[model samples]
Target chain A: MSIEGSSPKSLFDKLWERHVVVEETAEAPAVLYIDLHLIHEVTSPQAFSVLEGRGVKVRRPDKTFGTLDHSTPTLPANDRGELPYATPEAKSQVERLIENCAEHGIELLNMGDPRRGIVHVIGPELGLTQPGKTIVCGDSHTSTHGAFGALAFGIGTTEVGHVLATQCVLQRKPKSMRVVFDGLLPEGVGAKDMALAMIAQIGADGGQGYAIEFAGEAVRALSMEARMTLCNMSIEAGARFGMIAPDETTFEWLHGRDYVPKGLAWNEALADWTDLRSEIGAHFDKEVHVDATKIRPMITYGVSPDAAAPVDALAPEPHSEAEKHAADYMKFNAGKPFHDVAVDRVFIGSCTNSRLSDLREAAAVMRGRKVKEGVVALIVPGSEAVKHAAEAEKLHEVFLAAGAEWREPGCSMCIAMNGDSGKPGELVVSTSNRNFIGRQGKGVRTVLASPATAAASAIEGHIADPRPYLFAKESA
Target chain B: MSFDPIKTLTSRTVVLSQENIDTDQIIPARFLTTTVKDGLGASAFYDWRYDEDGRPKNSSVFNGVDPETHKILVAGSNFGCGSSREHAPWALADFGFRAVISSDIADIFKSNAQKNGLLPVEVDEETHKKLLASPGAQVTIDLETCEVTFGDGEKGSFPIEAFARRCLLDGVDPLGHLINQMPAIEDYERQR
Candidate 1:
């Protein structure tokens, strides 16, 4: 069981070696069996159609889970939305998923079910996302499930169809990139800040063609929610996926859950998790280290996630070819101070930052303030579970009282897949990952900021420091 | 449907033109819901070839061109940017684009295209400019010689990693081509 003599193997190496189907060759790509396949309403239709066209059924239906989240309307507790069930598009898509799942006998956590939420959020909450699992979804944010020590990745519809029919995917194993974040984060900094800071250090395409393994003290100490945020932005950095090794934090999050094994089986699972860490001396193709303490409250100022600046720093001056190119496209003034930059809107939601904690933080800032005039602030929770949790804490009331539009759970305004979008030329201070041009809407500029910054920006109508609120609260 | 692979690509002169066109833009998020066959051909250049009116915009390079006649698409640097949607290549293939000439391509998009039967040809900037200037210039793409011949009989050499080239010449996808290597996989499994 030892790896290459007495040297200890990193959890990544162990899991990869354990799941090695065969070494890649010139003609043949390695085929790795998937442990879990999470599907949403958006991307499963074509995959199902492909299967039907081929007269093929899902190969491992038992390993699959389907749900409706991306397009589900989040209505207030008192008033249900106009749509009785899912939206027409969502309903049709969900129907396709349900029919396909039934035909294949796969589990479907349809909308309105307590377990149904954003595919990323629900997977971990229900304990279906576990260590050493190979999780694939049709959404890029599928990397969010890798927080549970699983090798999770997103696939397109064609690949989804391939997986449905074969239970395995033809994949070229990615080179491992280790991103080690050490030391404790300062107050006002959260997982979103950490992820943004990482993107800031490494340009958006730094991890291209690589699978990032997030390690070190900071990553280890992150809660399951925070870990999900960390892995959620793997695609933002152009990495195939980002993963963390399973530990007590991961097991604790999974325990007592309905889907998780209990009693004697739990202990057996723990023993299995012990082997999930990367071995000492295990080699990585690339290694990046970011000092967590050095990271500040971050905000993206341009088209890409990497086009970011610290809360206290001015907008970056592009000296390099890549920076100049991105800056020209983004129309951002080089070396210009970003402190007084005006914002037309503030959005707090996405697979990256729409959790209960993110809502609570934004609520804390909006408790006694109203959204500034001409500034539209929207708070969309990541999932129904998160929305429910926010209601339980009265965070929604705080947001609504502050004139913020508290919308339902979904990837609202994240990529503007649905009707939720920002107007062209509007400057949006978003908590979502990626500030790329037209990422929110055509010509709508996005400035990715922390939740506190987003809330403050909504209140002030410009980028402002969140530390003052935390400091004032501390003094009180 | 089968054609002579040896005689098919007589001209290797592929033109390269668009920049940072992502896979999502190629197939778009909407078309992703339909069956591959139903959605692939018409949706290849959905956004690029049409105006907001859904009419074929006259300015679109791909618009109004006969599919069989337009065998090559010259694209600018960093083409195929967004999500790793393999439908990009499927759409490209269905549109009768045998090869995409670009300075560079997104990693996943390139791999997907190569895996599925589209030849992604990478060339230098100067060479790309020259190919673009050669309007309606059909290049003799010889899979056997692995070279692209311009209209002027100038041949520009390009490297297609041995395996990928072999797969393209054989007219088989990577997955289908791998059937020949099952014995090695079986032996490895036995050892394990």
Candidate 2:
């Protein structure tokens, strides 16, 4: 099992090799031990029903956690009584989740609980997600947990049922792809820009069927929040999962969290984590690198996340017939400059960017500024915890003072699953992932950007650079 | 275990000219909330074929077509591009689409479709165009030969993976394919 090279293998290679259950079995799928499983209101119902039909108890309830998001309404605290949850249809689903969690002995963070938020967000914040763990959730954004150096991925309801029944998942090991980013990012260029630039470099399917391990100096220096942002969009690049090995920054983030190891166990955990780096000269199936300094604040003009370009760069000329056809369908004029394209709305929230730091960045831009007249700007925190933290820090006040509507935490405007959506035909600057046509709502045009860019777009009523604000804030 | 591959196909083909049509749109997220047996066929193409009122739109080709008669879906490039919801293929299979003729399809969607016994025929652009132009032009996809023939005798040989072809011909799924090798597996298990 020894990798025979002097050059150290990347951390991804080491962990993956360590977890090899069966060596490429053609007759049977490999069985992998799952360390943590997170579930949400949307994808857990059918899984629970399956368990019920089988009369089986969750095999590893201790490793499972549940939360309510997606369908949870973002009504003002005062208006909770009048919200959709008050309706029978919504209430039953929410109630069923509570009952299911109780029946399975799984931890339930229902709506209104301070810990309640997007399942992905709460997993890491509470130290439930850790390095070397295999995490799966019934949500696509589950890759967000990979920021902790875990192999986290999304699963379907049936797979969720299977995991609950057996506490093991049938999996085929994926080929590994290493993505390296050199140099430091400029002030305004955040993790979202890094992810978008990577997606753009590698077409949407470049990393298909591979686990991408992000490395290099730029990635190593990123905060846990930034790393989560990088991993959240791995799915967009068509990677099964994205991960970064846990470092000092990672350990510091998990130090005193509720579910994290304590005292002697904490020291032992650190010792193990320290050994988690890749072995010397381990081989990867593929490797790609990006110059972090070359990437600018990016935005998506088309449906897929990969259809993106640097903010200052003009939209690409349609080089292929497929490109021409797709551009025509999206009504995007290729080769045309989108320099001051006005936006009808701006959204700043979702699992991708609803973090506390994300809110702070947006707040810095909104300070002493008002949202452009006639344009709707909304901010939804990713989780109830984030909402509370932001409120305590008065980030919500800053957003509200700037004429932005501050709402509760949920997956608002990210997928339009809940009722939060933009009107058709309206152009929006969003901090969420995916800009697919009607992704926000039917016919709504979305431009995915960083929170700072989204906030600046709201103030200027068009796509604009946030360099001045970010720099000024950094210096002050 | 042998099955008639041609009998698995339907008579009429419906064309959807769009690339990157996701599984979510094929079967909306709402339907995913229920069990696998709660009738996904009736809800197939729920988003694209209907308006907000749940009424079939005249603009959609699916509006007036009888479910049983329309067995093949002639789709544009990059069909089935989103979430790996097997329900997309389930709905399509349940709705009587025996085969999907597309210039391209997302890899996972194609695999899921094949596993569910829905033939995914990858045709060239020229063949796809001719098929679309002539709505009544029936294309016979022979799984045994891996060839497609239109009514005008426009014949083209398409490539399918050997494993997938074997599965389709044998009327087997991935599990079924493995089951066929049970003796060897048991022998290996005994040795272990």
Candidate 3:
């Protein structure tokens, strides 16, 4: 209630108040209008089936978009028209999605379509995810779209069908949390590192049922791409959504995107988006202040996102039973050096960290280097568009020359739905969002790191710190 | 087939002692096959159900007793911490578990549980410890009163969203609710 001189409202509170389509019972969950509904193949087949069973047509086809990811292949289809997926089961899922979206009249961004990308990536790049709107997808990483100050969260496929049918979702209001990273970030640390550091401070489940907003000088200084990387993994911190106030970086990134408002409409949209900030005296249910300068390049040694620390730090002691299990699962011993953990493979792409800028970060690290012997390094861009841009800028050459495979875009090795998985028990330094057991493959050991860290580890044959290996251009 | 409405259940609790037991551990992503919703129970906890080479792990609850017989799960705090997979609840429900009792539960998982027929009962730490200590204790969850009783008859009331409670009691989902009240909803829309 920012009625007149009422107390200053937080970012989420303001956005929440503006987007409620229906005011239901007092303190009851409200019917929130969803501005954008992103659907991907892996999670939507069941949702569409549910819709068909109910005999409902999609309510707002214009507002909904579909893309083939997760189940799509990084390698192109063979001469037989069969996708290069390990399982036909995966291929059929994406095929079902194509049919489902076509039947519903929703736009499906097929592979090799320049617009086709990770749903999260394409949503922002096409200017679909704007400030002060509500977004949902059947996938959890829909939180990635929240970087633009949108209230974005992932819903289950059941809710996905509901949103498709009504464009409105029944939701309980999430409490507000503001985590401020004050001061300047230390050198060699970027958004991914900052994300890991934040998770370290707040455990995996710390931000449950909270719409978290990042604020302060450190967050403000990040590039829009970096800010997206930060917000992308906020789900790992147990938040369905995370936001950063729309400032110059956010506006600049949105300015000329494919569908951004133009001319007077652009100016009007900008004015509205510019005001999407927490009031100076905003109330937050929980507030965490981080000394950004103290943060260093971070990495996750254990299975969960919260089992993270500074790259140079040793493995965490197993004080808790969960830690013990994670250590056992990872085949890692406490008190061992983090970087000494050898890796057999390295993957650089995901909705979490696969964009033009993320590729550039890895390219810089790979420029004058070579991937270590026996390391199967790969660079899969977030979209075909990102891949084309990287190729034009010679980032692809840089990676290829350094022995990293430049593959087509999809969620390659991210969820391992595609055939791009490392051998079982093979340790991998991956840039994907999850480090869950068997997430990459059966019994595959995953160590989550930033793109730069992943590149450096590829070159070093272990989980090496990227600070010492940053290219002069990157450091400068 | 439509889900059966779970009004009341009494059974020995299956204790899974570990915090932050994520959805992946509940059901790994690899087993997330089939657009079909029913019968994911056998695949649930696929890894925990079996050892590395494929034999069923002796320590697993699935192997120990019929999951259908033990209708309640007493897990450590922060159960279902990762991913928003509704499959987790579907699997648990397929196994005939009516409810999950935890000191804390992730927001998405709890919401997913509510939408499905599985009830989530959040007990205090002390109550959780007693339940964990006395594994197989006859825990009875009364959805009518929102109370979970076990551990020598000590009981605690867990809060449920009033809207969700009504739906669960009526054996309906949100889709069902909207369908049932379509006329009233359209009238309200027209008034607006």
Candidate 4:
């Protein structure tokens, strides 16, 4: 894969070079080919309208896939079988995607289809997200696919249209950054904790204008699902692209999935993917190393994701106007430990931590414990596949027994677009990615944490560390 | 949809001096259900600009300024950090903003702004500080020279890709240009 006599290249450099249809220059960007374009109800409508207005058919319908998320509700119907859409427009968005996909001859995982789920969640589940491919979606968490060692990123609707019409996107080469995690992660800390810890070390904008390659001992030790969780939040660190080199774990997780190649082709794909890692002496524009062992179960106390501290730490004193503003909005005692921060709601699902393992983690904490009285806890699986798998394991009974609502799969309560959100002024410990102001709901204070921490917090009615519950189970 | 060509614009600026002002603050996810891309101007920064009762907030800078005259929005560093929603830029353009100047702009947002005809200008920190300190300061953006002229004759050059710049100047639709390269795309796909 190396160019003749050229220096050893990083993983990102290899992926970028492999996808270039036209080289970048002073006058123009490189026209990079898109290997997979994941579309969903919320972002694809306008892109489809633009395509219809331009009077062009999709260039490669085979490479395009659609799913319904965001606008679709997590609540199922009663006797009438109505979908409880948040609005008429929300319902129409889902209907429009079905129509658009039918017209364009693209495959769509429609509602009630077992394969349907959050766009990011379903991509990897279906094996459409493969190593060395360039994946783009209108959703920022498109970086989720990069865990397979692909060059995946989020694109605006305009670029979505460009990819639909031409199968190529105009992209300038971004700088490369390697974020290395030193040492093994502690017992209670998971990938979500690692991600928040990294964002805290680097400011929210630390990885801007660069493609971040997550490397190091802890990252290598993470399971495929955990890797996706880490890469999924790369956008929060302001990196458009985040990836890991594909290895045995990646191939094992992807094997025999719906769209992945068969036996002979699988061997060929494996050989190509094995070469996808960065070679020695590869150059990086920047390198950051964080001590993973020191990264306890983390939680964000401010509107920004980087406003994070360990679960047992005291609420930080405000340093800037922004920090003061965040403190006022979040309403935490300045010097009190987060353990005293009472929780009003708990949301244990999002593209960030709604996979099977994430559900199992939450279920383990809730197996015999009860959600504190008056605290509304909702457990929404990421996808229907995740839902069915969890149901087979009877995870729903554990959540329901603990007084948490077990809901259908979608991007529920994550963006608050699907009629699932915290009430105004309520404090919610959520496993979702962003904790932006009013993101969960107007005037709502969002504390981002891992599934285990969220589940433990729900049980205690406060921000409780997960180590006690996890250790108790190990001893049992 | 071809945007109106933006060659030069002179306008007073509205400043939101908050770092990491993400797209959710620009246009919340709830207002994104529309199949078309129009009328989002009213909902741009809905939570910031309006109260729960749907009335404009008295403290919001948006309510104090006239969109027609204040076409330049000067924001703090790392503006438009989260989400890949083009509605963020569409809402800005629909609200009559022609250019956004920041010390650091998120990569996807800067791309979306250019395609939708809203200019994204990234200047030096000193210039950004000056702009942030002076709200409603008259600013001039000249795409011809890729420079932003502001208070007291101070100026800073911003970078825009040459292709994006040409497309903005011509008011040509980039999708059309990309569509014309269908043969090249097909050839590349076939070789792969």
Candidate 5:
């Protein structure tokens, strides 16, 4: 994408080659230096125990930061400090995170910290996520940071411990993929729709063993916030990482941030980041193209993210033998409309779509409307700063007046480990990634949708397209 | 830290004949609350391997066979496909599956399995089909030679990189390679 580069090295190759702490050999894996290592409560405890057993301190502790997200509660919507965990077991995990961070001298943004939020959300908000950095977390959604043109991906717990001890993890160079979306986006579509649409086209395993670069005019047209949402769900498509080339939009979004470079350093960084794109004739192992004009506000009906369809279309008849089983698991009868499905619970939160822009769109839908009776709608902010920012904009009043519970920021209902879940046989229209069976709760049917669709569905008490409502607002 | 080295695994196979059987299905998020790893063994494959209301299914794949008897898992393409939750490998390894035989294995899952003392062996389409036909078939995987031998002498060879093979055969993590080369790393750092 940059004009100055030659020889056509892809963005992934540029990032990977610079981070090679140890080059790969015929007999060994390459050791890549991790610029940012994120730790969370659910996956870090066992890893910390491994570190203790090995008696090795974290290498370059400054580059590592800890937060408790996946296992914390979002209840008590006030300053009650109830530590109001869903269960005693959840409490112990957070406590262990505190102990581990303290013992290891790693900084943690705990429940009470104002900066505390989902790791992916707070990382960019604080400017810890930047262009050309190699980041890793135990959660697969670490792909979220790739929006800033950084090479970020997830790793397992043993790899987590390995990075903790050495500031490096064993990795092989992934095959390169370029999925370019050309043309203008249609009305009422967003990054969430684009992501779901991508996964729908490429099967769940299509991007296996590849690092994908989401490119072209349509991807470049999105805001930084929307780009984050797009990159965040790249893992669901099975790509090791998804990236976009850093551009003016990226630099504008990152300018004057807390953790970014200052003054002279900022100008130098801006110049370097500007030149960070692939060369003119870069080659990829695989290439895919999507017409942005064709994408709709998409949602997943079956368990996998690939089971996506437009709100106007009927539930697709299962073609594969595996799809038939997926439909059966979701209890979605073939030939039924994907729309007008009844909703028992509507959750407007998750790392996938809980940012301020997400709240604005959801609140726009909730304005002058009330949630249908008997439908439990909870809108959780991604972080405390997000919570305050939304309240400052009075998004909270719109949500509360529309009969939804606006709660504190945390990873609620996404993991189902935080005591927030739909009851058995209940249908939940959620904005979270991974509608896998039992992901929300035991026997709970989950439909993955955008925040706007979730908000409209809460009011209609079923899955309804958000486009009509947004069109009404435009006309008004 | 050296754990138990895996040279061979001879056991009855349990078949999950579904493609893209993800990590979430292997171990659901609800049971991912503990730091300890033992109880996870009991809850592996909780939904399919159990009935609702917290009762174990009498005829499920896991319950029908003694956990001590079946030490191998047979699945289809894209197994362990979702979430980098090491819990998937932890649950499988804790449940005593020393090896998995599949037509294709996911990238992240293979790496996680290598470190957690679980072997992911890929076979040709014919072998996978033959393995699927026989439900209670006994299979022996020899890690030293990367060969899988069926009870009736149907043999197959799966490729393993030399470095990973040494780590698995020695029950060591790749980090051991780096730790062993600390002196060389020091020399390079000094020159820089």
Candidate 6:
């Protein structure tokens, strides 16, 4: 994107070339400067402990931001004025992050902050994420920021320490991959479905060792929230980073948000951002295309995210030992439809979903529809901001009317680290990302779906297609 | 934290051949609330190693093996996928796996493992099949030569990033390396 030469470069190449502080050599990885560093409680404590032991201050505290999500309770305090933490360790994890951020002079959005939310959700909502910036977070869903055209990816605790001490992460450039979704997505299908369908086409590890750029007609047609949903699941497909080139839609969404450049600075930022796209002949190491029209409302039938199929399709027969194990664990009959799979729990929040638009999508399906008996549905907002926005629209009333627990903002049941979990052997249809074994809880089977699909399944007490509900709403 | 230098490791392999063995399986999220890195070995593969009542399951894959003698884990293809938890490698290292040999290793896990002194050696499909077939077979992994020698005198070379190999061979922490490059990083930031 820079005026390096007439040679065309992919978006990943452009982003990579911009972030290199020192070129990689045979003996060492490249020293890549980070513009923004997002940290959460679960992974940051050890990194902070290591930094404290070294007696080193954070290299650039201004660039670092912290929040508590993974272990924070979505339920409010009880009559004793005590937050019901999952365990003493989970409570201490949150406290440690607050202390560390204070010690390092880094900005932290603490418990009472209205801006506090999931690390990935708050970043873009506050406009801290922007085009052409290199962002690193201690959470894998940090790829959500990539939908804004930032070169964002997740890092481990050691890398977290490295970033804190030096403000740069050592890295090798990942090869570029371009996944283009052709044509228009049909009604009743959404970004989560597209993500699931893409992963199903390409195995769970399809994008390994590569940085993927989601492009083409469907990607361009998506709203910022939908794009985030699509990109948030990149890690499930084994890509560390998933990005979209910034366009007018991105600029419009970010224009009035907090932390964005203003007035003359805004115009200058836009000028540079317009050049962020890959050129016509830009080369990608790998390229994949999905027929958007053929995609339907999809849900994972197995433990892995890639074990996805259309909601109306029959459950797949065990193809391998792993599949057989997954089938036995999931308790799904090979020839039966996913619709017959009973759902005991429905969770409609995570970094992957739970944006205001995602909330609206689910609320539209839940309005005037009662949740089926024995199915406990939870509607958690991704951030405090999203919660307030949805509340302003009275979306909570609709969920409450439908018998869903309208909960506070936090990861909640997604990671099951916040005392919110499905009972053992329960089947939960979740809008969150991972469905790995015991992800929701011990012996809990997780089926990943979109917010709308989750809402419909909650109403039906089974894994039902969302198209009928969506169509019924349209006609009404 | 520092790790022991791994020049050559000759040990029997502990095999768990289920493909796409994710981080959640390695160390479930429930056991991840700790701030410190120590004592995670007991919880490594917790779900697989324990029954619902919190008792150890004798039929677990890790039951028969001794951690001291079998220091290498030869797992299925696409091992360590899903979450970006470095805890996965930390748990494995604490459980006495000095190396993880697989046909395909997830990108982030490979980086995390190398930094934590748990080497991820990715072999070709044929070699992986051989490794899978011979679970406790004695294997020698030479970091200096970047090669793995396994059962029946079969051998294969594995790929590791040069910088990671250097750090592993020298027993140096990558954080220290990044800290040393701070001046260059500041220079780049100033220009921006």
| Candidate 3, superposed: residue stretches over 4 Å from native | A1-5, A24-27, A471-476, B179-192
> Global lDDT of each model?
0.74, 0.78, 0.84, 0.92, 0.86, 0.92
Better structure of 2 and 3 per TM-score: 3
Worst 10 residues of 4 chain B by lDDT: B172-181
- Using DockQ, rank the candidates from best to worst: 6, 4, 5, 3, 1, 2
* Distance from true location, Cα of A43 in model 5, Å: 0.4
What are the per-residue Cα lDDT tens digits for candidate 5 across A315-419? 878888788888887777678877758899999888889999999989988898999999999999999989999999999999999999998888888878888
Please provide, for model 1 over A433-463, each residue's C-alpha lDDT reduced to its tens digit, 9 standing for 90 to 100.
7675566765577889878889988988888
Docking class of 5: medium
Distance from true location, Cα of A325 in model 2, Å? 5.6
Ranking by lDDT: 4, 6, 5, 3, 2, 1
Error of 1 at A307 (Å): 2.0
Per-residue lDDT of A128 in model 5? 93
Query: Whole-model lDDT, candidate 3?
Result: 0.84
Model 6 achieves a DockQ score of 0.86
lDDT by residue (tens digit), candidate 6, A76-154: 8899878889899999999999999999999999997999999989999999999998999988888999999999999
Q: How close is candidate 6 to the true structure, as a TM-score?
A: 0.98
lDDT, residue A296, candidate 6: 97
Please list all clashing residue pairs in model 2, or write none if there are none: A7-A280, A7-A281, A8-A280, A8-A281, A9-A279, A9-A280, A9-A281, A10-A278, A11-A278
Candidate 4 local lDDT, residue A38: 94
Measured on C-alpha atoms, candidate 1 has an lDDT of 0.74
Across the candidates, what are chain A's individual TM-scores? 0.93, 0.95, 0.97, 0.98, 0.97, 0.98
lDDT per residue for candidate 4 within A240-274, as digits (tens), equals: 99999988899999999999999999999999999
